[model samples]
Target: MNYQYNNFYEILEKNAKNLKNKPAYFLNNRKISWERVKKKVDTFARALEIIGVKKGDLVPVLVGNSIEFIVAILAIQKLSAVAVPVNTFLKEEEITFILNDTEAEILIASSKFKNNLKNIRNNTNIKKIIWEGEVENIDENNISFSEILSNFESHEVKELPKRNDLAVIIYTSGTTGKPKGAMLTYKNFFSNIYGINELIKLTNKDRFIAYLPMFHSFTLTVNILLPMFYGSPVVIIRSIMPFSKIIKETLLKRVTIFTGVPDVYSALSRAKLPFYFHWFNKIRFFVSGAAPLAGEVLERFSKKFKRAKLLEGYGLSECSPVVAVNRAELQKPSSVGPAIPGVEVKIVNDELIEVPKGVAGEIIVKGDNVMKGYYKREDATQQTIINGWLLTGDIGKIDEDGYIYILDRKKDLIISKGVNIYPREIEEICLKFPGIKECAVIGKKENNDEIPVAFIELEDNAEFNEIEFKKYLKKHLANYKIPKAFYVIDELPKNATGKVLKRKLRENIEEYMK
Candidate 1:
């Protein structure tokens, strides 16, 4: 914990020398500035150090959401290497099993994922492929990330990297299965943008849309390194399901920060267009974390956008993700604000101890954005970073003004007759029902015990009525939080950065209990 920020390419070369000519990013009608994003991140960090790609070498990229994924992740951290991004929607045997499990050798990509990695280029060992635009046959040892940034020359400035090495690996969606590699560092991504810029302030005339998924650590630290650590601008947007062009690129690019999830605010509260389908209040704060939004999607965007606020935060992916955030003088509609400055939140018990205020346990944390573990799996990083806290398999509590709340996932609770439950409190009473749009719940079993089970999704031209959706979830649930069964689905199985794949909805309830 000695970080006085040791080089993330010297904080993007000091925000490209103090926001030189400002505008930092606005892809797809191109804006770019911070001095042409620091001369294309120093000519792609001298074309990734003339292909030897040094310091911790991982590279990978596989782009989509361009500015060549921000000049290949600040030119793989200006040659300290380690980026690893991928997930240009995976699959080519999960992108050659993460370029043969992160032994990656510089594969940068985006000419449509280099034409889908040219059909698994003879099963990738990777050794240099670059490719961002004109994709032709690529066989002759592939190269063309704008011709390796026009054959690099940029020179000098090198030696910086070690804030505990490894910069980014990410991967998640393992859901108790395969995908591992979390790693992170550069002091877990610059102490999570200096601990969420000590609670969100952001600058360079703000902006922010970034339709989540720069291989998501909530858009790699809230819309990419917290809006490139305040030289802000962002925009990006490469599909988070076309909500009418993400509401025409957040109200014709006036976008002053949007950051969604919880199905992009229940698909813009069931969009029909002409903007405000209840609260897009022309940006400036909409937030909502990677999942859980329903309090009827924040009461229909506060009864149709009464000048937007929606906020609700919480974290995971081992906390470079942001721990608690609800902001605006700590507003707590379902909590999650409070613990940001140098982060500490407690809860414990199972002998780790803490517990008191509003009881529920296991949330832990201790900050400078917690992570640096899980990559080479040290027994799954000693069952998740013990001595300095980080447990967070989440089950929360805190309130008494320190906010927090959360309560479900400690492996998504629900014990049934032995009591517990919390399927996000019956998927927030089956998302207050009129056409339900998205839900999950999951507990199921029965004769052998357990119970709950929901899996919904509805709303595209509605009509599932199911006894008025269980009498509008019995007027906001509590018959053990309702849902003994629902199962609708036109979609609901996310996770590539869209959350809700509750283990594929509990393997579709073990194939409907076989």
Candidate 2:
């Protein structure tokens, strides 16, 4: 990829000069200009430096979505320190684990998460804590965010960070086990920014939305960084609860591009929206990522909003969270489209041999967008990246036309008596049933025999009859492929990015069966 800027600071400085008065972002009624952001970033970096932050220092940030969150990360990069953004949804134990593991000395957190840090000072190595909101119970370790911003004058860094320098360490959502931190350089991020922009046409004129959790890689790359790379303004929503606030912002701010998960689209597909909202909105693209989009959700959403294209995308944290997405020029149903420009994606078998087109196998990617490796896990780094190809633990197949179709996660694959069963195939068929709104299939061990069992989430006030559902499935699938049992639920457990928590299902299967 032909990246224009060497690092994030380069882009920020350029935007400060080229688009000085332009609004960098919009939060509710407040508009922050690029010039103002640049001043705050430099001042914050100066204060951090005075506090002993140096090159290669890891600073943990537990802040939520706010102007402080953005400026703090820029300041960390400005001082050539690695920014470790922890998920705000994680518990105190999980949060402490990351801070202790990184050996961080400073933590930038929001006031809302103070309850989680009530006992944190005794547990971790964090010496200084910077809070974004009101400071009531101030101590020696606590510092106000506003005070830090005004304490120091705008200062330049002694040394600028290189493109290869580690910029961020993103902790994966620990569904299977302990969260692993993925080390990403500035180049790994810039590669995806340029690659995705090449496929989806975007300019400085377009306005985007940042409602998803910024700690997630999908939100950080596609929502936050991409807009900054283009000098486009973003509408920042604090939380997804009462998402009608997001709708109000979209219409009022004239947002042109939106990114969401499958659940958001499914809810929108069935919303009783007025015709005027559709006629007046300027939305050009509706992109889905983080998890696979159900065929039912995709179809209903496209039919509801014909003017906007609903493009399904696929990616993971290891690949800078953007491997491929469908473009406006061409789109195939249920496909994530082709790999982005300058990135090569292929399928391989168990022996690491290339698989033929239309054959399902492990998906591996090779590009500048691939991350450096898991932080402090050399064995894992070697196991994941072989021969320069990042072995994505995902199973998929590529068509002759280069469109990619993700089958399922390799770890989620179910084996029953020498037979392989992909849960997505069964879940897709289950979603087509009238009352079902969401579905998940997982392997259940019963008396040494493994069988596929399904969990179904139904629509509002909908009733389900197992006999009819079984008869319907028998027509579409063979006997061995059918789920042995079905459990109805009000809603499936989901992460911040709307990915179904299949691991949670596996853990609770016994209790539900009782």
Candidate 3:
């Protein structure tokens, strides 16, 4: 199939040519122009090539959101190398596993995570490590990302990879087992931007704030890639905490585009410093995704920021992330709006047959944005991408006007504060503890919100300390991954197939709550 331009480097080049002297990024109280960006990207690509990083090789980027992150990603693509972005919050073991699993030969990690990388460097096959911050005594095996650009020289652009070639490997949290890497091609990403651009009209003048972690699909495609494609100036915000800071930056910098999860909106709605500082309404719009946005939160935000519309949407890592979003003018509450252009959505039954409109069934999507497949997992990919439809394990239905409404998560994954937490992954971690014999993890509703709960059976005549257990968990997992409460049980409920019946666990919680 003949495709539109697939190489994202080429997209940046085209945009840079048009807006050469225009401001592209505001970083550390400095403005970078598009022309300067183009030259830096080319120089960084040459630097990567000189360091023995080859085309199609997986290079893990663990840097924070900055112009450097943008440059590294574009530089890797310029050299036909695939970019593997890792979450900075990952534990050492998790980081090591990702590097090994992706076969990442070159690692570009931030200074904050350099110590963790140093501890695991001897255990992995990573050929080289480039720290984002300055480091001394690093031999030929280790280099500083700054040093690469210090004596950088501009070079001719290399031949770009085809659109179908793999460009990114975004690992989604695996509910049933290990996290699987979803291979997204250049075509997949551009198609997503194409679909989104057709629906949400963003211009070069729009100034978007990068709030979500760049490792995830939501921020990667929407916040970073989309803005760059249109040559929009972006303000990068590394932290999403202390809500006041985010609001202050949005108001002070005059950011037009705001995208975050429900937690961020909920916090903003409840922010009560003073009425005189209601200047957040200056933003053109706000977008929420990665979880269901409560209608109450939306209403409160609308009332607080009367002029700006709060838009909610849906998608997954496998779809190059965005499937549908609500239009500001034609609004709907509690609905994920319609499927973006070039994407097809369907509610299907067990036999893959489409269900009638308004009936609840699994939501399926087919489009250029659909991922190639789970890397090296053909069986899993086949099961997911059947008959050209990427079955999003989300239960929902569409109304007569094509508005998609998400009812429940078809997969047993818990999304707390926009981060995906898989039951199996948590259960595995709990089982590794000394006393735990068997475990089942489930999401229980608290104040109409979802939180992770774990039921565990102890060993024969075993004793456990909840306080110490909590500390142990904090050491191994992220704050959100740890369970809110742990219940001690004699045995876990399971079916004939040996699958833990998480439904029963949730039901037990309901009965107990009642």
Candidate 4:
């Protein structure tokens, strides 16, 4: 498909005109057509204008995965304003840091997070607060979303943003430190949407499940933008509570494409589907991203579903969130498949020289999907994107067939006794233990030497014998690669995207060891 349009407004207008009454979103058992979405977005854009939002302004959106969240972002884009999506899971301090850092003038938050916003309202640059749902205490600056839509007239922006203009500033998950905003332009999103469409082959008849948070780049592109671009309807679940209900809804809605993290797939793998309901047969395929999908989890899910294949994908927030994905025709469970169209990926050494096919090195990407830069952080932008290629901190290798295999994050590598050790390898082996539910391997500094430490989370009513597990590891790993200590914990710290927080594990190693 040739992408004739540049900005998001053009796409929405075209889809609304072409697909008209076709459902664009499925929220709370209600189907919102493309025409309705366009109308709502237009009214919201006018409301934003009345509230003093203008071109180039940053509007921080702190909402969940609901229809309002989708409409708010589209409205911001229509007005040519930058949407800074804040993770709803963030604390007041973290949200405040992003708001003050971006100097966001407008904040659009859901009712559930009103208190969080109220806690830091006085410390932010926000002049207007648009509340999506009802709140107990409302202030002068707090405007109701329903009131805005009812009061404002449906209108278009006088001038739409150019393709190169900034559209969204997606803040990183900040597992290590303060999150940095990645500036994505209108062109970046369009190019990525086109590239992904070429690979996924989504159609208007397809229905996706939008359970992941929209703040993450992965969900924004795949779940939200992709469906809107194709004029496909998305089943937007406000919450993932009562997992069985979500499954029943998927089956009832006949959701075609499901995108989720490893944890979700793991849970689904263990779920006992009703004998009468063969709901999974309606799903065309399942996609795993955000975190590494275990082979064991994939095998179990594939066996259980029996209809859809769970394809593992790899990407980062900087690359419009999708760099490589497994094509159904040429699927490889171990590899993340080849780079998607319009993206160039190559493995390079420490000196940035291209490495051999089988050798592991830093993965660098050169593509239109790459972010403009880290907002207001020139040093970080320079360090990340050199020349035209973005230096992805992930360590990976490409096979002779062009498939990419991720080893581990470069920063997560353990250097013990001058020998480099990948924690992923250790963790992968540890997960094979029958009782182990989840595990993370990290390096502990001990007398100027890095000691490999393993943190294990056991399944319910499961027990772990350290000596037996260590003996099992000896068969598959070398003596030096084995973890020096094993600590069982109730749960491992994770970010919103479900990626294990290794940095947190390292910080709290003392408590875990005790």
Candidates' RMSD to native:
21.6, 1.1, 10.5, 1.4
Query: lDDT per residue, candidate 3, 1-514, as tens digits?
Result: 2446868788778878899888888764788998888888888899889988778899989987778888898899888899988877677887888888887778888887776776666777788887777687777777877877877796875578888899999887543456788999998998888888877788998888886777878889988888987889887877676567776777777788998876678667766856645644458889987766766667778888887888898888899889999987787877989988888999998788999999977899999889999987899999999988998888788999999988766767676766666665566567667766667777877776678988888878989799999999998888888999888877776522123556667767855444
| lDDT string, candidate 1, 255-313, tens digits | 87787787777666655556453344356688888765667677776676667677888
> Order of candidates by TM-score, top first?
2, 4, 3, 1
The candidate with the higher TM-score, 1 or 2, is: 2
Clashes of 3: 0
Please tell me which predicted candidate would have the highest TM-score against the true structure. Answer: 2
The C-alpha lDDT values of all candidates are: 0.75, 0.91, 0.80, 0.87
Off by over 4 Å in 1: 1-40, 47-49, 52-59, 62-85, 88-123, 128-204, 209-211, 216-255, 263-299, 309-430, 434-493, 499-510
Please state the error at residue 330 of candidate 2 in Å. 1.4
What lDDT tens digits, residue by residue, belong to model 4 across residues 1-514? 3557768888889889999998888887799988988888999999898888888899999999888898899899888889988899988888999999999878998888876776665898788789988865566687899888787899766788888899999998887788899999877887778888787788988999988888889999989888878888899888777677678778888889989999999888877778756643488889999998877787788788776777888888888888898888887766888998999999999999999999989999988889999999999999999988999899999998899988889999889999989888888888878989999999999999998989999999999899999889999999999999999899999999789999999888888767
Cα-based TM-score, every candidate? 0.33, 0.98, 0.80, 0.97
Ten-residue stretch with the least lDDT total in model 1: 273-282
Question: Model 2, 1-514: lDDT tens per residue?
Answer: 6677778988899889999999999998999999999999999999888878899999988988888999999999999999998999988999999998898988999999999998888999888898899988676578899998877898887688999999999998987888899999999999899898778778889999998899889988988889988899999999987988888889989999988999899999999886778989999999899999988888899889999999988899988889999878888988999999989999999998999999999999999989999999999999999989999999999999999999899989988988889999999999999999899999998788789999999999999999999999999998998999999988899877888889999999888888
Q: What value does the lDDT take at residue 357 in candidate 3?
A: 92
Clashing pairs in 2: none
Candidate number of the best lDDT: 2
What is candidate 3's local distance difference test score? 0.80
**What is the C-alpha RMSD, rounded to one decimal, of candidate 1?**
21.6
